[model samples]
Target chain A: MTLYASSKAALRVYSESLAQELSSQFPGIRVIIVEPSGFRTEQNVLGYPMQIPRNPDPAYDSVREKSMQLYTSLDGRQRGDPEKAVELIVDIVRREGKSVERLGGGRAESPIYVPLGREANNDLEAKCTKMIQVVQKWKDVTDNLDHDDTNSVDLTRWGALRFFFLGSLHAYRAFQDRIRALASAGF
Target chain B: MTLYASSKAALRVYSESLAQELSSQFPGIRVIIVEPSGFRTEQNVLGYPMQIPRNPDPAYDSVREKSMQLYTSLDGRQRGDPEKAVELIVDIVRREGKSVERLGGGRAESPIYVPLGREANNDLEAKCTKMIQVVQKWKDVTDNLDHDDTNSVDLTRWGALRFFFLGSLHAYRAFQDRIRALASAGF
Candidate 1:
């Protein structure tokens, strides 16, 4: 299964854990997590404050309006082409051929110690490498055992709520930092 | 997000619809659905047949013995290597990167008809393709620009009773077919 995440700082961890669980239960399957840079969409815009609604803050209004204008001017070509987006998905299907993953979005790179859009993709790659490595080690230990024998759902296990919350929060904080960086960068 | 379906047939549909929902809401993200062949695992062989004790089928004892033998034999090396599986998954991650619909399994040249495994891998794949193609076409027409969409769910969509009767029956039939295939192949 392959999932495309727009912001690594946004929904990356959520998608990753889900991928792992699916993989464990189903044999001969693969989960693909893709982190793309920001894209201009109906719900989200890069370097822009959401226009839906918020507390009245005159200080932030000017910048918000400017961001909205920039997004609107881009039409549908802000981050990447929408048609290209669809094609990319189809291409993956063609390439993978038989085993396919469900899709979603998150960031492609790190959010730590860098301004918005400045985090290197390699760092995110590193994170993914570590994740898979740890999963490998764990699988080695449990591969021979009956998963259902110990099927008691343990929240402290790798596939638990606490892990999810911690992981998601870390990603969320990283995203917040990125948004702050963008705001500071005069979005 | 990508989902590795427990039963490649039904879960494939679930993952497909999920991919569409995520893609429409979060454009840059991709969803991959991986349909898997059976692995030699406890989950694959446990509690296979349920006899109500007074059942009068002459073939029941033979089937029960066969199920027990399959379970006992599938301890270690006979199982698929988790590392190899992970590598395949990571390979897709690298190739598709951020696109959705990546399918990974052991095979060459994407064929409309893949060969059947004793465990019914080909059947699962065929079923998955049907479900995805159908839903994909449906989405093209009913993107549902207005009301709240009711397509995807985090868990089973069917209620408890219906799920037990229909879903469980479907899974059981698949399991029985697998057993028959494996037995005939002299496994």
Candidate 2:
């Protein structure tokens, strides 16, 4: 779960940056970041607990192992439903895309981040605030590292942290087909 | 650089996942992650009077040495420069990108995490926070694992730490690009 969380955080930021680049460089290609929270999926039924490779060093901290174990415990018992999430994504994409140039320049703010469930919204908010807080607390140190003349500091605030709280990349992998199927259905 | 920072982090994650997959699935397109941090660049030309990688294992604390010295001075002055960052990438793409999409939209992002500068923001933050507080303060038992299931222990603060930090993969040498012209572009 340790590597998994960071991996997802990396994904979240990558998605945002990609969104920015794609939006600015190419027109007509819209990207919808569907950030879904936890769901009871086949991953819980099949993947975890035994899948993640263990760090064999005894000197290694045990908290990571415990966390993974805890995550496994919540398997198949998560809150959000994957079927509903896919259904929602299909619905949103279908409704969200609108060709503006053909419609007198009228445009609706497409839902850039489709947070799937209530738990996801809370998690997203929490990650954002904490990311800022961490940066704020470490502002001095982070600031000291840049070139003396450079006026700005680099701070990454990941907005999509919540949807990945469940550490279920495998679960998502297992369900990707289902979502893609739903999406292709008129999406 | 906010986006850059997160981009690298995302890349680190992406690279790891890719490496795992390519090794397991494709068996052809080998993936690698280059996690280099800190060097005597133009900035360090004025900073760090005695560049690191020279702790001869004395006086300096081990943690600081492990974190800074080992990172600060590579066995030799870092061969890669800010400009090589460009030339190196170009050489890679001249060969890396295959078709428009088959090269991989599955390649949403590739994690070639070239962690430049001693100021790897997140890495620094993690080392600092844990080193100071966790070591200076919670040194008693930061190693203990937990299973109490007390609701508030929202884990995942570490999901993104490692895959970004270990930062190494020997796969790059297979194509250590033959570019030298761009490295001297007044960088």
Candidate 3:
């Protein structure tokens, strides 16, 4: 679970960066991140009862046992409808049906994130709140370790500019590629 | 930069989970995460003018050039004192020196995080605030995707309980091993 959660977290950050990188010079391109709760898919329901490790350490015995039990119980009880989720995603991408207005039509900026299900929403909301609280609580300690050198260059600003420049270069290359393809096709 | 940032983000999350896992059962075991801003280390000051990639893509030329320039300009100009950062971390860990009062003198809970410098603090605080704002903005979209099953079991709560149980089991095994070793050594 830790591995899975960590990978998902990494993907989330990567997608956000991708979205930011593409939005400026490539207005037609979009990077939408979908956060979905568990759905009652064949894999979730029937792919459990997995083979236990033959030489599992005794220290992890209780956790392993309880995890198996939990997985078994929740096999077919997931509360997400995969079909509806897919349909909504399609609508959002195509900008058709009910999602057209929900996605801000042709004027307002479209959302880069599509968090599906009450579970995803609640979990994300709670996580954000907890993070804000923790940072606020430790503000004093975090603010005291500087080297007393106020004239140093702001590296973060420079880093952001570098990324933005890179993103623009990438977008220009993609645009050139598309134009070349169109020209070859006699457009 | 994307790859490096994503990996660091993954490590942060993994460390947080690890700290939570060990806190309940192993009171003596603590996981401290140190977030350091750029310091004027030998590597930072002297490791510039790195070898350029042999077959670098033309699409990345601009970004690559700008990045090299930025790195050269910032060499030996970082505003962090590495010695001070190390000394403070040691003090915090040993609960000695001026950090004794700063760390609550064995009465209050110890901090699991050590953000060293103004840059780390400001960047983290900004990130947290932005996350909160984004979540709030998209609250409506996230809340509307439920499957209308109010009677579904709360899986997040169950997952938390499982981890806690696992942590306890691990702690018990560790305690038993310690006792056995002590007995054999005539302690």
**Per-residue lDDT of candidate 3, residues A1-187 (tens digit):** 4554556567767776666556655667887776766544434322445444533557667656776776566555655555566656667777876566556746435236766666665666666666556556556665564467775556677753223322222223333454466569795
Off by over 4 Å in 3: A20-27, A50-55, A96-111, A159-187, B50-55, B96-111, B149-151, B159-187
How would you encode candidate 2's per-residue C-alpha lDDT over B1-187 as one tens digit per residue? 2244464566555666656545534555655343433322333321345343444655444434443443243322433233333333333344342222222445423333223233343444453353233122211221121222343223234342232221111011101121122234331
Order of quality (lDDT): 3, 2, 1
When sorted by TM-score, best at the front, the candidate numbers are 3, 2, 1
Cα lDDT, model 2, residue A43:
51
Judge candidate 1 at residue A39 and give its lDDT. 28
TM-score of each: 0.26, 0.37, 0.73
Lowest lDDT sum, 10 consecutive residues, model 2 chain B, at B166-175
Better of 1 and 2 by TM-score: 2
C-alpha-based local distance difference test score of model 2: 0.38
Q: Model 3, A90: alpha-carbon shift in Å?
A: 2.5
Alpha-carbon shift of residue B27 in model 1 (angstroms): 1.9
Q: Which candidate has the top score in lDDT?
A: 3
Task: Compute DockQ for each candidate against the true complex.
Answer: 0.02, 0.04, 0.15
